[model samples]
Target: MLNKVFHLTENHTTVKTECIAGVTTFMTMAYILAVNPNILSAAGMDPTAVLLATCLASFLGTMCMGMMANLPFALSAGMGLNAFFAYTVVGNMGYPWQVALLAVLVEGVIFLVLSLTNVREALFNVIPISLKQAVSVGIGVYIAFIGLQNAGVVVNNDSTLVSLVSFTDHFRTSGICALLAIIGIFLTAVLYLKHVKGSILIGILGTWILGILCQLTGLYQVDAEAGYNSLIPTFAMTDFSKLGETFGQCFRVDFDGISIVNFIVVIFSFLFVDIFDTLGTLVGVCTKADMLDKDGKFAKIKPALLADSIATSAGAILGTSTTTTFVESSAGVAVGGRTGLTAVVTAVLFLVSMLFAPIFIAIPSFATAPALVIVGFLMFTTITEIKFSEKDYVKAIPAYLCILAMPLFYSISEGISIGVISYTLLHLICGRGKEVKPLMYILTVLFILKYIFL
Candidate 1:
């Protein structure tokens, strides 16, 4: 039944392989179960409610990606979008969380309309093929940078903006965790080279076991205020009724004191970021998996976008930030997940997490950091497929900018923005204007206006 539905055999994969890939994918991204609540809690939300919203929304989105799109991708509350919801819109702008969720709901509806009309797909098709491959490589660096940050291997510096962790301070909590991450990186890389099945998952569990040992021996203390918690796994019954707190709150928007212009801007902000982030992740991951066709497009893209739009709208109603396709799906793709069965497994795990939230949430970021770092390398290797000739330098240069901008700017949308602008502009300047499509001209103008106004 599974094979007939997911076409597992057609994708040259087995149930065992897909299941492992799904589990690995979930393990790597399960941090959202821990993270989304904390971030949304800052927006005057119930942490427990946000956790429930996250799990349910993710289950709905990922299931859509599997059953509707038939792709090995996962969806969850986006990291940057969550921060924007809590900090920029609600905290700084002084709008209530309800109004902010309304903005997200509206944005998702807009995306749904655009996707249905093929507007989003048209925008996606205009991007040059070389730039798409560059997006893959850039996401590699971008996600790797994220892993380093999450593991405390990279720290912020007032002067330089980024620096390595000072091993001298907080040695037990910060220092040892960072060290384990570095060790995990090496361990995972070695396992990958040895061609071990489930190497990435093993790497995560191994690093987590090391952390548990540290905690058990009193080497790693529980410091909740410091963002360090007990590594030991525990089981508990979560208060399921908390789900009612956040559900359907987006519809309860109170517009009593809402500024019309500011509200529009907020919705546009969510729309712009979610559109590009979802598309960028789809293109980049497809590139790495060799899933794009000769035209450098995902064959299942319409449904994928539809699924994303559905998830976003559902997420808003569930009282979370925007939901979008996750780049961490690359971890599964890298591990040979090629069918919807992988996404289904991931979806099932998300459903199970509502019951075992604590155990899954306790799987710390440092443990999963190595898998991302390793998968980034796997994705980065596709850089060799890009053309680098003199005549293609116009394409290559923009691709290069796209690659660097992602990690440096810390936004996938920014990378796509720069890529589109530079690609179109450079081609025009090089007397290759005819090479740029009509939609390319439209996108360049739209992107330019976005920077100027929004």
Candidate 2:
């Protein structure tokens, strides 16, 4: 029955191989079970509730990818998008978390409609290769920057904007946390160099263990006033009833004091990042797995996108952030996963993982920071694929601006807006206007209008 459904024999893989691949994929990406709730909790959502939402959304979405798309990829609440949801939308912009979820829901619904039509593909093709690669690199840099701050390794400075942690100022609290995080980054990097699977997850646990030792030895102190949490992890059995905190919260948006134009921008911002991020993951992972056709197109692209869009909407309704295809799915493909059975196995694991929510919710930012830094390196390495081409500098300039703007400006939408507007203007100046697609022109105008008005 498995062979009949997933064509396992035809794909040259076995049930055992697929199962192992699924386990491997889950191990690598399971850090999300810990990290996502930690991130969304900053937006004032209940961490336990976010944990349940992540588990359910991952199970349903990954299962859909298996049964509908018949691919080895898995879905989860995406890292960069969650940061945007928590930090940019809720923290910086001062929007309520409920409204942020609304924007995510709208983006997901729009994405689904586009997936069912040709618009999404058309938009995908219209963006230049350099810019697409830049988007990933930008998000990588942005995530790494966030990780540094989370680890307390980077601190605010009035004169220079940012500086390293003052080891002497908070010796027993923030200082020790920063020191452990720095050590964790080195440990994780060495593991990656040695080809260790689940290196990121291991780094988190290792750092947490080290922290516990420090706590016991009087090097690390717990002081709630100093923002230092207990290094110890509580292992209480998971409470399933906490799902009520976040469930159906997306529909509870109150827009009484919200600006209509700003709301539109928020929705578009989520849509833009998610659209390209998913497409980029699909292309890169499938290409490496040799799952693409001779024309370099993913055969299951349509269904894969549908699964991603469905996951995003489901995650929002479940009271989290946008869920999308994880780039870490490449881990499964690298381990010989080639069929939906791998994804199905992964989905079951996600469902089974919900019972461990207590531990997941306890994982501190300092512990997870190493995973973000490592995953940032994984995403940032794709920067080599951008084409500058014959000193024209037209393409590279806009891509460079986009890459720098994301981390510096602290907004992915700003990077994209600058990239689109600059790309269009540069091409027109160079007599290469014809290369700019019609939709590209439209986007350029809309982005310009956004700056002028909003």
Winner by TM-score: 1
lDDT per model vs. reference: 0.93, 0.82
Give candidate 2 misplaced runs (Cα > 4 Å): 1-47, 70-106, 225-227, 249-300, 324-350
Cα error, residue 320 of model 1, in Å, equals: 0.8
Predicted candidate 1 versus true structure: per-residue lDDT over 308-368, tens digit per residue? 9999999899888999999999999989999888898999999999999999999988899
Q: Indicate the worst ten consecutive residues by lDDT in candidate 2.
A: 287-296
Estimate the TM-score for candidate 2. 0.78
Which candidate comes out best when scored by lDDT?
1
Every model's Cα RMSD, please? Answer: 0.9, 4.3
